[model samples]
Each structure stands twice: as structure tokens, then as C-alpha cells.
Target: MTETETAAQSSIWTDEPFDVHAEDPFDRGSFVATVVRRIQVATADDPSTVFGLVGPWGSGKTSILDRVRSGLGDGWQIADFTPWSSGDAASMSLEFVNTVADLLGEKAAGEHRAKLAGYAGFIAPLLGAIPIVGSGAQGTAEHLLDAIGSRPPWHKQFADLSQAIQTLGKRVLIVVDDVDRLGGSELLTLLRVVRLLGRFRGVHYLIAYDQDTVEDLLRSTGSVGRSAAFMEKIVQYPFETPPLPRAAVIRLLNGVLEELLAKTDSHLDHLGLQRATSLVDALAPQLRTPRALGRFREHLNAFADHVSTARLDLLDYVAITWLRLNAHGVWSQLDSWRHELRSGERATSLTETEKLTADIWEGRIAEAHPQADRTGTLDVLSFLFEGVDVRERRTFIKHPRAMNDPTYFERYLLLAIPEDDVDDELIRIVAAELDPDKFREAATALARVLDGNDDALANLAISRLTVFRENYTTPNLLLLQFLAERMHVRVDEAERVGSPRNGLRPLVAREMALAVLAGETSAPDIIEMFGETEALNAVWMAPRFAEFRDRRSDLAEGFARFWADRLRSEPGAYIKGGRLGGVAELVTFALEPEETNGLLDPAVTDYDSYIDLAEGFVYAAEWVGSSYTYELQFRKDAFRSLISASTLERYRPQVLEHSGKVEYDVEGHPSRDIPPEIVKAFTVDSLSAL
Candidate 1:
């Protein structure tokens, strides 16, 4: 009823050929004019001329014939013959003769119509007398000759028709299309009939076919090198279809893309127009014809409707879709590459099979797209598989930039990983869990269905927790914590969530504790599962918890006390096992507004312990000064308390000297610089107090 509804109902890509008389979208009118002129010139010189229009399948041969017929106007009588639709050679011959007679009879009146019917009668008996038609062919031919009483043979009758056509001052143009679609026997029979019946003086023939295929068919009759000679004898003038222009093809493709985007409910802004332009440029050389562009649209229509919700990179999705349609072997190899990249062994180090598969895929690309730039095409492959080394053999490693980007990683999984790897039911369960409104319901439903008997589902749910971590929305984080809690409950009941030998309880528990600490979802529940020490340990290792700690000091202090107790019980372990690094990180999280200055007394273990405490205090001071500023005076007082007058005198010169150096060779050391102003503040504050 509405304009939008009407537009949506129209298809973006139709499988049918374009209408012959429609406006030319590809600027093909110039070529059509040239072809029409050539046909007219040849037919004017000799009315019996046969013109052959040669082109590949789906290369607009039929459209060209229609244009040529239209260009000829009322000067000639045109009989359009579709030989392929006739089913058999005999039927095709009959259709051709009957169509011409009808056209001619319609043009002529009274006496001329009677003359044309007389010629048609003479040809009918001869056509029936052909051996392929039926039995009693010789008797029927003899009887027809006797009845006519010395009437000329069928060829003589056709000559009379040609003479009658000339006398009537009319030229007949017979257009035959898709001759290559016929079988070998049917093709030979049709050619023979055309050579015989199409030789009238005032009649011209325009036949269309793929020359290479017809030549092959002729060669199969043992003609070998003489097939070209046979074609020359049949056709007076031959024209090969020219290559469609690249710019024209791209313009047509863009039109199709715009239509598809308009019809679908997708976030089109995410499909970067610049990247799509680059991809279209890359694909232009391979899409040599209009039909190739149509096929690409068909494949895109099938796969790209869900791209907005799937959150796939539009460039990567288009590249993969192109490969799936054009180069199937390369697509299969890329799927395998995705599988290996997800595997633990290949993630850490490349395997022999992965190396071989990459090489095979490169070779296939070269073979399939010889005209395309190999390096540029492989760049698309590199986008999908980060570790692919298209140039060198031994230096294959994942690109660090792509490995760290979450968007690129998500696209790789969405496109490369097969649906069967994670069953549809499991994927549905995961998707439902990720929804904000459905989070609680999906979690409860999964807990009921997979409490004890479904370890596989539980493990799948656990494995996908990392996927949700990248989506740092509040609702998504809450759902991540909820799913982790459900899995922990299952593990607590002694259910086999993972392999018995590996025991998934510890891994799931660690993830669950980290989720609570980073999400600040259920701190007490986290402490119950991993106990106080292990819970604090897991939180210490998790990244991006500054916001969580800033808002929840009560939870932060509980973890900090657990860390302090561990340091007190095993002071020697803190020095020997390099645990001071962990202590430094924990102190930063535990620093609060109320009691920040008093927390450092627990760090006094020994004389050397004072240096570690001062480092931890300086790190925490820098963190608070840069990140947290709610109570600035209290944080400054906390920094002065950790370093007394004597301790400041002891460490100030060492800290300043280390900071002055341009570079240091120490490995796994802190690289953050403590501002000299903070150290000077500590000394001046102590002097002021004195």
C-alpha cells in the first residue's frame, strides 16, 4: 500500500534477462547500433546473406539480436525463431518454416497470399519426406511430384518463393537464437536445414551461438581443423561480442548493492563505504560479464541479510562470499585455516598442516584468478587469518595488530567457524544468555536443563564467557557473571563439565571469581567459591578493574586484607618468589579514602621489605593521583605516610637516578615513571611537620 512496501517487494537481483527494448544500463546502445549497421550492410549487398553473432553464454547474445531486429524497423519482415524451445530438430525446422510463412502471408494480400501458400505446399511434402521424420518418405515424395505434375523440386520451389519475395519488394530477416543449446545431432540437423531452406534470394538469416562450442561439436564429427571452414561456408559475416567495460559493470553492481541495502533492515553505516569500494575494485577484473555480477548478488542475498545482528565486518564478509561463489577450493581451505587458528596448538605455534594448507590455498588463488593481483587478493585472506604468510614460507606468524583487535577477532569467528562446530541449540542458548532482558530467564533455564547430565553444554557455556568479556556493556557483563556462576554451581555438584583428568572446576572457578571482581556482581559468592586467598589472587590478575575498585572500596579492602595476610604468613615467600609485584598491584586496588594512610603498617616485614613497600606505595600514589581524585588530600596524606623522612632520604636519590636514564635493559620490570614532584612533596611535607 505504501511506497516503502512496494519497493521492498521488488527483487534486487532477478535471474531473468533484461528486456531488449529497455533503456541500456551498461551503455551498450553504441555496440548494438554498430552490430545493427553491420547486419544491415551485409543483408543489403546480398539478400541471402547469413550473419553469425558469436558470444559466450550469458553474454547478452539474445539481447543484441533483439536490438538489431528493432533497429531494422519496417524495411524488413522479421521472424523470431527460438530453436532451443522446439525440443527436436524436426520440430525446430517445422517451426522455422511455419513462422516465416505466417509472417510473409500476413504481409501479403489476396493474390500474393495465394502464391505464398502454393510455395508452402510444395515445401511441406518435401519436409515430411525427410528420412528422420518417418517411414514411406520416397513414396510420399513421388506421389506429391505426380500430383503437382512436374512441379519443380523443393529447392526450386524455395527459389520461386525468393523470386516472389523480390517481386513483392519485401526482404525477410529470420533471427535464430541459442543454437548452441542443441544436442550434437540436433545441431547438425538444424545447420543442415538452415543451409538448405535459408538460401532463398530475398531471405536473410541472423544466427547466434557460442562459436567455440559449435566448433567443438563440428570437430567431433571428425572434421578436426576443417570446423572453421564449415562455419565459414554457413555464415557470410561473423561478429564476436566485445568485452563489457569495467566501469559499466561496477556501476551496475553498485546499483544492485544499493537496492539490496534499501530492501534489508541492516545497519548500513557499519559497512564502511571506502572498504566496500576497495573490495569492488578488487573484484571488477574477475567479474567480466553482467551475469557474473548477478551471481555475486545472488550469493550476497543468501548470506548477508543478518550481517547487522551478526556484527561481522562487511569487507570480510564480502570477501568470503566472493570466494565461496567463485573459488570453492580456496573457501574450504580458509575454513580449515579458521579451525586451526582456534586450536590451542596453532594459536601458540604453527603446525605443519597449517603451513601446507596456506600454501595450497595461495596456489589455488593464483590458478583460479590469473588476472587478479595475487598480493592484493591475499591481503583479504590475511584479514581473515592473521597468521597467513602469503610471501615468505618460514616466517608465518599472526599479526600482532589484528590479534589485539576485538572487532577483527569477532569477524574471523563469525565467518570462518562452521555452524556445526557449536550446535544450533547451543548457539541459541548462548545468544539468549547474552540478551539483557532474557539474561536471568536463560540462565535459570540452562541451569535446570544442564545441571548434572549435560557437561558438554556447560563446557561450551564456559568457553564462550571470554567472548562476552569483550562486550563491556553493563548488562553483558552481568550476564557473563551469571553464566559463570551457574557453571560453578554445576561443577560444585561434582558434575563432569570438562575432562575428568583436567578437572574444569579450577578453571571455571577462576573465571567465575574474575567475573565477580571485574564486574563487582556478587563479591561474597565469589569468596565462598574460591575462598578469600584464591579469590583475591584471581582478581589481582584480571585487567580493567579500576572502575570496579573505585566504586566498591569495601569489596576492594576484603581482597587487600586477604593479600596482606598471605604476605604476613610467608614473608620469605614474598621475597624469593617475586610476589612483591602482586603486592604492589593489590595495594593500588585496596587504597581507600578513610583508612588509606594506615594500611601500610602491615607491609613492614624486614629491612629490605621497606624498599618493596615504598615501591608499592609510590605505584599506588601514582595510580590514585592519575586515576582517582575523589578525595585528593587523603590520597596525598596516604602517599606521605608510606615514605617517612628517613625512608624518603634513603630512596629519593635512587628513584631520581633510575628515572633519569633514557633506557634500561631489565626484563619484566615496571616502566611507569613516578613524577619527581611527588618525591619532592614527600620531603617538603616531612620538613613542614617537623
Candidate 2:
């Protein structure tokens, strides 16, 4: 690509420093002008002066130097030197002297060039020998002073060279940058040259470095408490790079986001645009400097490209990017949590160690980016995961629409997984609409190919079922069965409302039951397609079958006969098979009140069956209260029948002895009221009858 094209494609928050002569995007021109004025005033009285630009790494130190160089007028001559490029301390000093000589030669005419070259030649050998002076070489500095005293009146030659430059009335500015990047010895040597050797008339030095690093380096070299004193002697003026304003940082971030969004063909609606803006505003405080903002934008751009921003939840995307940038430890923790949440596990309180780790990480982030509002970042996390406890601060997302949407968490998982391993076919399938026949074909093919190992595909299938539930005209038995089995594995591991086994299966079964009652399908056909467990599931969830009894009485009658035969063959097997809830649901459609009573009457005659039936009644009572009143009345009648006057006389003392009180108040049976007769059957009055 051409340079223009490349620049067009580049992120607006590029880390490269702005050209000094270019338009200042950060509005740093005024600051640069002020520094230039100070340097000019300071050097007016003193011919030689040094100014230090102090800031932390990636704090725009070099950019400030560029601005200073660009601001100087024609009366000044400037040479820029980076000591880090030179190999050692000796070589750096030699390079500095050579650069000054070359600048002087370029400025001077014929005879003065010869004079400047002689002075440069004389200083070259002495600069090379300065390294030995610290190594205990005998007669190093003393010998150099003596040698200078005897040779060609060297002091007069230097003075004449200085006067020649003074006659031109042009001040030479030597700019040395990134001195803190050098080794301890190299840094000290560069300081010595600027402070002691290069102190010539009509020349000023502007050096830039991180003050703390250079001071620590000096202290490590035996300067200890005197490092600040030494720095004061070398640097006449010092200035710290000012913190970039929060508004400027946000504007730069938004500029990059707009560029990225405009270049891609992604469809961001009003909600997506609002979320993107909120993310930028939320993270604006943490991005204090130009470089930090650049790094954050870099991460965001790469993630957007990797995940493909089309139809994505921009808020979740931003949250994942922030975690990746500032709180990577938390990012890893969240990835693990995603798997756990997908596996149908409940989110419990954090363990002590986990709590400690989270606290330490939050503290680290807060300390590193004090300008950024960490509370906003933590709030993003809480929105993504339902139970993320960021200390005692309870954070909830303000956008309820985004939080309610399933795509938010789905997009988060897409970014959390490795890019290479993402199942693109599954993602496409979940997002697209499939007809009943196509859904059955695709679901069956996927189940056959995957053999149940890929949880990502399973998750996509479950999500697809929700979309299909509202749109598909006809129910697909094969698709529903496949999803049920896949979800059953997760349910067996842990039963949670988020699990497809517990959450989607009932919805799937209800759809099938509706098809059967509407005569769109049959019970035998359903049983043939899915197994008995699913057939039972369909009958269990179709309790409203009575509403369709007038139109489909034949199917209701057939269903009641089928369930009656099953109950007679296995007297208490339905309750033992963990279908107590389904049995209660069947009361409204399949089983009559008399049939239910007959099914449980044998339980009162048999002691072992009575215990199981009693437990089933307790569960059924709880389950039926949430159903239609007819189902509740039928379950209550069955319970009252089991605890008849004679039956209660035999078992009431055993029931009272085995249990303290017969309490029927539980979660599912919110308003379940036990019959006063049944309550009296198990009370102290029943013991007298026994």
C-alpha cells in the first residue's frame, strides 16, 4: 500500500509521535511555546545552559523535544542526539562531540572550519580516554590536563573557536533524548560530558529522560543522598510532561472507534452506537496518557477484526477488551466462569483466595490508572456476569435492554474463545432462520457429526431453539429430541435454570404437546420419533389440553387411557422415576380424579409403597399448586383419599412418630393448602382413633 493508503487504514490512536511541524492534535502547542520562551530567557545571560525534560516512559518526552526543536527561530542551530543508539559510554560521548563538530563545520566558512576541525580532533582522543579515569588508570584526568597545558596552546585554540562562534551570534542547541534507556555507566558518562566536558560558550544542552530511573541509577553508583544535588548542578531547568486532559483522550479514542466502525461493513444500530459511546466514556478515566489510550485502541481494533463486529453487542465487546487490556487476570477468571455458567453451574460466592485475588487485581488497576474511573470498569464486569462481586460495591448495568438480550453474553463467549477454534457454522446457524424441515436436517446432521463433544455447538443449538420457538410454524420432533438429549447431559451434571436441559426442554416439550393436541401430530408418532421419556415430557407439559378437548377429544381420551395403563402396570413407578411433577400435570388431561385415587389406594394397603406414595403426594401437592385449579383439586383429592379415616388411623401414629409436623409450604407450592381433613388425619386426634 502507498503511504497515504496505509495511513488511511491505520488506527487514529497510533502510538507514533506527531511530527513537530504538523498540526498539534493534542493542543500541546502552547505548552511547547512556554518551554521555548523559558529556554531563550535562561540562555540569554549564560552562554551555556542545560534543561531537563522529565517524565515517565511513554509520557511524550521525545515529542516535547521535537516541539522545542520546531519552535526555535533561525538565530538558533539545533542538533538532536540519542545516546541509546551509541554502543557504550565512551562511544556516546565521542558521537556527541562529533555531531557538534559536524554542525559547527556546516555553519562555519573556510578558515573557521579548519579551526573547528582542530578542536574536534583534540577532543576526540581525550573523550576516548575519559573511560579510563574511573577505572583507576594512573594519571588519567591529571595527565589529560597536563597534556592540554603543553600542546599548541590548546586552551587558546578552544577559546578562539568559542569566540568565532560567538561572533556569529548564533546559539547552538544540542538535544539529547532517551538518556534513561542507557545503562548506569552510559547514563553517568553522558551526564559527565554534558556537565563537565561539553560546557562551551554559545552552546545549550536540552536532555530528556525519566527522572526517577536516572536518579536511581545515580544512587546505585554510590551517589546515595547526593544524586539530587548532582542532577541540580547538571540540569538548570526541569519540567515534567503534563497529563493529557481526559476530554482529549476521549476524543482521540472516539475518533479511532468511528474510523474502525466506518471502515467495516458492520451494522451498528442506535443501541450499538450508544453502547460504544458509553464504553469510551466509562474507560476514559483509566486511559490517562496518549500511549495508554493507544494500547487500548490497538487491543480493541484487533478484537473487532477477530470477532467481526457485524450485529455484535458493542458493550460486551468493549468490556472484554478492557479486561484484556487492564485486568488480564480478571479476564482469564471470567473465561473460566463462562464455561462454568454454560455448564449449568450456579454462581456461588467467591472463595477467600478468589476474593483476595480479585481485590488485589482491582487495587493494581486503580493504582496504575488513577485518572480512570475504575468503578465504571467494574460495573461493566458485573453486567456481563450476574454475580461478580467487586468488593462491597454492587454494580448493575444501566442499559436494561442490552442486559436482557442473549446476544450480549453470546458475543462475550465468541470473544473469550480462541479465534482459531470458534465454530463459525454454529454461529451462523444460530443467527439465521431455518424452516422446520431445514432445522431438523441441520440439527440431526450436527448431532451425528459432533457426537456431543462440542459444547459451543450445543450452546448455539439451544439458543437457536429459542429463536425457532417463536418463528417456526411447525414443530420438529427430531430437532427437539436432539436438543433434549444434549441438554440432558448438562442437566445431569447440575440442574440450573440456565441449563438447556431444565430450561429449554420444557418449552420444547410444550410445543410438541400443542402439535399433538391440535392434531398436527400424534402421541404414537411422537413416541416413535422421541423415546418414552420425551413422550411423558410432552404429556406432562400439556396440562392445558382441556382447553382443546372440544376439538380434539379423541387425542385427550387416548392420552388418558395410555397413562392409566402405565399407572396400573407400574403402581408407584412414575413417582419413583422422578416424574412426580409430570404426574401432577397429567391429572388435568390423562388421569381422572377417581383413576388417580385408585392408583394411590394400593399405596395405603402396602407399607413400602405408602412411604413412596406419601413422598410423591408431598411433591405433587407442591407441583400442582402452580397449575390450573382442576389439576390442583385432583391432586388434593388423591392425597385426601390416601389419608382416609381408616388409612390415617393405621399410619397417622407412624407418620406423626416419623415426622414432627406436616408442613406443605415450599418454593414450587407457594399457595398449596393441605386439606383440613388430611391435616386432621395426621394430627393428635388421629392417634386416639388408632
* Clash number for each model: 0, 2
Which tens-of-lDDT digit does each residue in 40-103 have in candidate 1?
A: 6644226588888898877878777888888987878788877676544345555665666666
Q: In model 2, how many backbone clashes occur?
A: 2
- Candidate 1 worst ten-residue window by lDDT: 395-404
Candidate 2: tens digits of C-alpha lDDT, residues 1-690 = 223323533845566776666665566778888889987774422668888888887778777888888788776878887777765444554566566666655656455655544554455456446643353322233333334323355587778767765665678888988888887766776776676456778788899888889988887766335887888888988877787877776777677666566545445677667666666766777776667766776777776764453334455666677766776655555544554322223435574223333354356447655543556656556545544445654333444323234444544645543332333344345324245555555555555433455545455555544554555445555555555555444444554334435545555565666567566777666666555566666555555434433544444555556655665566567767755434444543444555555444554566545555554544323344436231122244445533455565566656666553554322343343546444333433223323
Instruction: State every prediction's TM-score relative to the real structure.
Output: 0.62, 0.62
Best by lDDT: 2
lDDT values, one for every candidate: 0.55, 0.58
Tell me how far the alpha carbon of residue 430 in candidate 2 is from the true structure, in angstroms, after superposition: 5.1
